[model samples]
Target: MNNNPRQLAFIILQEIHRKQAFADFALDKYLRKNDLIDANRRLVTELVYGCVRRERSLDAIIDELAKKKSHQQNPDLRIILHIGLYQLSYLEQIPESAAVDTTVELAKQNKF
Candidate 1:
């Protein structure tokens, strides 16, 4: 499995969506299994929890911005969007370009 923080966040969110897994449990499981650096581990935790906490607001923005509603979009794509938007909107330290580029790259990597 990919150890990149964003990639790991994607997998955790996918598990939450598909299996209704608890965020903390899934995150802890992955964090324990992977030898992520402190910063990377923090990023993964922030991305997963932030997305979950802000899901409603994110979906609202997504529905307004996308041609398709959030629920109508592919689940993985929606999660990717959430990751990007969370970083862009909440993580002031992250450059907007990096957020957009990484999120787009994730979508491409997933063959979306």
Candidate 2:
């Protein structure tokens, strides 16, 4: 697949936050529509849920670092950062730079 892992992860996350979509439904839809392999799809699912579950903590960090209200800040950047920070905080196998770069790229893509 041309799509990278983090990009796929970002998509799942975006669907969660923007659509308020459920994890199973969102993941199933993405898997049916996309060409991602099972492994990457699993990563997407995991990252999406993991980020969502930790949202309160993420919001705290965003509030502390960016000084913006959670509802007022750009959703795109927030999701991007959520996914990135999730990886950075929990995904030991994922390199730190990849998390930062992927989130920044997602932010740029959304013009945030």
Candidate 3:
């Protein structure tokens, strides 16, 4: 699995989505498996929990901005959007460009 915090968070979110897994459990599972620095671990935890907490709001935002509604989007793509938007909307310290660029890179990495 990728060690990038965003990528790790994305995978945790995907597992939550596809397996109906609990967010905390999935997050803990991944965190245990990956050797992340404290900051990266916090970032992964924040991204996963924040995105899960704000899922409906994120979906609404995606619906408003995307030609495809959130539900209509590919699951992976929607998760990627959630990661990016979560950072943009909630993480004040993260530069907007970093969030957008990293999310775009994730999409490319996944061949979306």
Candidate 4:
């Protein structure tokens, strides 16, 4: 499957969730398999690590914004939201609009 950084991040997140895979291992495996450019690969790495590290806080934001607990969400949707929120909340260099738009597209493309 063709994957942008956000899409790749979504897949990595799902792998982590479903397989209970180690976050670093899953991210590295996927990044190595994909043809993503260096920048996108870096973004995917950051998103995967950031989401895993801040999972509790990210879920809290999801809960507050969506009014649904993370466990209550579709797994893909939860992961997408976490990626978007992580970028928005932590990555000062990324524009807010880009983060949100890419995240929404990732969800739509994944049929979430």
TM-scores for candidates 1 onward, in order: 0.97, 0.83, 0.97, 0.93
Worst 10 residues of 3 by lDDT: 1-10
Ranking by TM-score: 3, 1, 4, 2
Error of 3 at 1 (Å): 4.6
lDDT (Cα atoms) of all candidates against the true structure: 0.94, 0.77, 0.95, 0.88
Between 1 and 2, whose lDDT is larger? 1
Clash totals for all candidate models: 0, 0, 0, 0
TM-score of 3: 0.97
| Per-residue lDDT value at 6 in model 1 | 96
- Ranking by lDDT, best first? 3, 1, 4, 2
User: Tens-digit lDDT track for model 3 on 35-98?
Assistant: 9999999999999999999999999999999999999999999999999999999999999999
lDDT of 2 by residue, 32-94 (tens): 777877788677777877888899888787777776776677777777778877888888988
RMSD each, Å: 0.8, 2.1, 0.7, 1.3
Model 3: residues with Cα > 4 Å off, grouped in runs: none
Question: Which clashing pairs does model 4 show?
Answer: none
The model with the greater TM-score, 2 or 3, is: 3
